[model samples]
Target: MQAVNGRILIVDDDPIQRRLLEEAVKKFGYRSKSATNGAEAVRIMTGPEAGEIDLIILDMVMPELDGLGVLERLRSDKIPTPVIVQTAHGGIDTVVSVMNAGAQDFVVKPVAPERLNVSIRNLLKTSALEDEITRIRKHASGTLTFADIITRSSAMERVLDLGKRAASSNIPILIEGESGVGKEMIASAIQGSSDRRNKPLVTVNCGAIPDSLVESILFGHEKGAFTGAVDKHVGKFQEAHGGTLFLDEVGELPQDVQVKLLRALQEGEIDPIGARRPVKVDFRLISATNRRLIDQVKDGAFREDLYYRLNVFPIWIPPLRDRIEDIPALTRHFIARFAAEAGKPQVAGITPDALDLLQQYRWPGNIRQLENAVFRAVVLCDGVQLTAHDFPQVTSAMDYPAPSGVPSNSAPIATPAPHHAPAPHTPGTQISEPIQAEQPQSGFEHQAPFGFMRNLDHDGHVRKLADVEEEMIRAAITHYSGRMTEVAKRLGIGRSTLYRKLKEYGLDDNGKDAAA
Candidate 1:
């Protein structure tokens, strides 16, 4: 979908200037949010919707809190959103003051759309590059702690708490989770938070290794120990000496290897292939698996004694759907990372409706699937903000209908992959393919006109008034660029009532009423 190029907060006291700037932002393929004065702008920059805002257009002449004041507040709060200050008189003194106060750029009051677009684009590009650099540096340092994890769910909090307690010791840790639930990240965090924080973290995926080579790969091998054994090898255990050894998919290890692994854990040493004696090793053990080790033990696929050793301090991570509360933060994090990586710094955040749609789906592939989806959306999206139409696969997989007014820039809908053989056809007879029949478009098909809301359901029955009201409010907010005053006035509701309805409907930026 053609997401808005970016979300620009317009902090201008003058209604005319705000409206004009909003229109210009829209024209430039970006979305705009309004703040009556600098104070409101600061509130927004520090509030729940902060991450979604890619840039700000600040007017210098606002009362209560001027553009310079806003810049100071943002700086003190460490908000990195780029700001473009606007003043009626673009004198050198005013420009210098704003820049000194942390403004990224300055524009004359009657800012031309072209000039404004260029300024916004350049700042976003620079900011994205800086963010990507910081992320890479943090990863390379291997100091990723629990704080680096983006989560707001209580379930994840418990996991982090358990992980923190477990990190205090070198006890064998078994992190159990479905595939892609970030088991490796948890393992890394454990190692990074442990005494071995400055040491190496050697990881081996047991499931990805061949059965014949599992033992040799984990415990090392001597030259000529087996066919084609050309040189002495230091295995994962040796490589992780004085550090940590993370065995991912540990449940997949062969039965024979499990015995040696148990012995190594118990004896604090390993007997490498063709070695004269056991070699001492000092490494922390962290194992992860998608399957239940208990089940594997019962099936005789895993040794029971080895299972108990690894399960000493088990930590289970919940799947994505169970922690839907984390979706907004995670989505924003991925958007930032992928947007930077894709060199589309202007691609800032996803619309609230898009976030809601994502939170509703059961992500069977978990965080890995979510990460990949955001990466794809960042690449496919042409606008600054991602919309529901950006995730066509998610929309199609969940059978979700596209929002009524948002136009899609996606490919044509393809039929699902077949799971069964095609039905038999008569010889020399033409048979109409049922799968080729016209299907309702979810997010990929060319959309209908904009500014119209669907009043009826697919069954032709009138939709509930509550649903229609919520949809109307959402559209009004998007249409007005989150100017609540304008939205309430247009909807014939008082501002307080509008805010109340927003709370009741759970339609604020973070998918809930931040004001409430």
Candidate 2:
């Protein structure tokens, strides 16, 4: 990879020291800019040229405004550019003050080129990571007010209305919905419209991470905190120190991680894994889950206090089936979007019958699934408008049976390592090897041995614990709104175990009877 280039701004009242530092910075292949005093540095930073300067070297005793003053201004203005303080005072108090003032790094007076260079390189690396995250989140780009949502249904309008009111408050927000129901979209809209719109809105996907990495990912860790922990990582909370931290799939958080997260939320502080002290953070919290956390709390899988804390401003987004009135408007918006993305701007709209078919159907995957269908149609279409033929699956979807726990708007399905594939069956084919055809065989030739707890009926005949355990597992699943991750967690079993039980019990995620 090519070396990361950066622009350095030198701020010192003394032209002699400033010129020396500028030349030293240039010698290291970094472009340099100069500021006569701290005041000038603040102006340039808060002005048009702010984005150009990656690192600032500010002298503490500048005539007009000192180092601390400039740092304070930067902090107040929320400028994330890294600053290195140059102070004659090498006292510990001065160093602490600089850090407290939000300066990223500092060096003692008569700055050594080597020491300054090292600090700059480290800060720039961390800064680059943060910048990339910020670019992806796009604090301002993905932001939405209620206006951006295309909904005609009053039910959805109420959700957007409450979201609008919630945007003005700093209270914790809990969004509940089925998967692909636009929970993150609502959370981002709230963050962007809130008072801290200019600050970062960091998102954490709780279920996406491995259990072992949960604590480190959410609370961060110091360098050498654990094996393979090479550098200090500021967690999601710190990343959105003044804005918002949206924890998606929060119910999937492990017991240990939930404990630490509870403490952080309650105390407004976090103890990084290897840090000497706890770091204080002040940010709004937004959590989303398709599962009912209240049920998980009852099952002892989730903390009661954390649930209460997050549910302060509860907003439930109704599923697509419940608010089908919004389908047409949503379809228009998505077609326009996917068409432009696919470089087919001339695509006018969907056919009237096609729109009717979409409205008539119950979208199990919600808005996310709808978007995928539209995008796929736009990419494959050869006409100016999409027809029912464009979405052949939609016509057949009514009769299609969905698999357990997999959303219609699901991400790419993970193909597990196959133990075996089913044998091909031809019409009128008969197996004569095993002639007892009345008893059916399982699809898999090799079934993993499942231990069962035996029980006796009132008649005293022995029976497997299958009936009792199946009821409990099925009830837990229904109560938790069919979130298998939370179900497995509450049932004190691994996810693979839960899958086995679900299949063994003939249960699906329909929130009703058995799959058969």
Candidate 3:
């Protein structure tokens, strides 16, 4: 059964341990698979089941391959699959090595089912949040006509519908979304399709302009307007007379500049610097902001009246994740466009499997990011179509799992693995299907998916996770009213482990009572 939470890949040469792990993971609602050894795990992870495998459990010591060896290989290839290394007795040093090599977590020999499951749940939760945040944070770019907006998603079609309607009038249009959902593209489309199409379409990035020059840039300046006034100049508003002026990132405009902008919009004119009289200007306003100006107005950063003026027609562009239905068409369009530009006759299109991964992958960068990724892949294309391996940035970014329980502000400690052979990619595999335990690759053959993390501090000191772990345990105990079970649940640890940690950290209230 496919897991509603996610899938797990268990790697151990020992059949008993593998079976035990499989049952434990399944008991926790995760679908799982087993690899006889580390080699098989690498193949499955880098091959067709690449996208499907969410987490991996590997034995530290195996026949031909070991857990540390596998971790090294993965780091070299930059695969971000969260790994839990289960080690044998007296393997603290090796476990430390595993942690330094970028393993998300490690389990000592005689693994308790609850402890292992707790780690898995935390990693999955963290990974999901990271993907969601990244998808919403990164921005998108470029300009094109409405006809160039290729999308099959109904959500996006509605965006287009509203944009086209707003374009017909001179009312200010506010296009919004998380960065990179193509706000600028919609702005361009509106400008292109609007009645002002024949007029010059001028654009300005409000956030990029220096605060001191914002007013002068928006409204023309005369000679001797200021110390740096070399010659009289027409600002964006005056230059775009009878045309459309697109102000991107308009939320960044300073309050002073906003007031001037309001006057320009309301009176249909501007006061040029050093001018004896106000200058009459006629330009259609098309402003765009990624942030909610409503919130800005509430916070007093934006003027309410000005916001209402600019928000006559508001169009929200959903992030790429919301309209993933457009991935295939967008992919095809990108492949063809980039290929022809590069004069690569070999580039035909994307494979069904590759397209699946693309769609499955969260697009933090949106269409602009997709365009860049496809262009890069096309340049690296050895086959007739773009393959998964060609888009390492996408795959690596997608597969990087965020381990839960990490503080929101804490950076994950990642260490670069020493030189190790990379994991070999398998052919003829699909991510959604069960991974067959295939023959192990001869040796470590490929680099980590992302280059392994570097030794962060001088002397490449390993972070003492024990200190952080103890602090967290104490914090949990204080916050949870000394309820061991609740603390364990919150921290993604088994009750026994929580008790052990409490005793180890001298925070065990029960143990204190017993001593008394």
Instruction: Please tell me which predicted candidate would have the highest lDDT against the true structure.
Output: 1
lDDT (10s digit) by residue, model 1, range 196-315: 997888889999999999989999999998898899999999999999999999988988899999999999999999898999999999999876565455457888778777877767
Sort by lDDT, best first: what order?
A: 1, 2, 3
lDDT of 3 by residue, 424-467 (tens): 32321100111112311111122111112222122334436775
Off-target runs (Cα >4 Å) in candidate 3 are: 1-145, 401-516
Candidate 2 has an lDDT of 0.71
lDDT of 3: 0.68
Task: Give the candidates in order of TM-score, highest first.
Answer: 1, 2, 3
User: Can you write out model 2's per-residue Cα lDDT over 1-516, one digit (the tens) per residue?
Assistant: 111145789999988898899888866646689999888999999997875677899888877688899999999998888898898898999999989998888888787888887777566655654543454455356455554455656666677777888898887787877788788878888887888887777889999999998888888999999899999998887898988899999999999988888888889999989999999999899999876565466468898777777766767676686677667556755666666668885564565667777876666678988989888888888886677788877876644443355333222221221233234222122111111223222111121111112233323344346666775675566434466787789989998998877777676654244645
Kindly give the stretch of ten consecutive residues in candidate 2 with the minimal lDDT sum: 443-452
**Cα lDDT for residue 220, model 3?**
79
Model 1, position 496: C-alpha lDDT score: 93
TM-score per candidate, in order? 0.61, 0.53, 0.52
Among the numbered candidates, top TM-score falls to: 1
Worst 10 residues of 1 by lDDT: 440-449
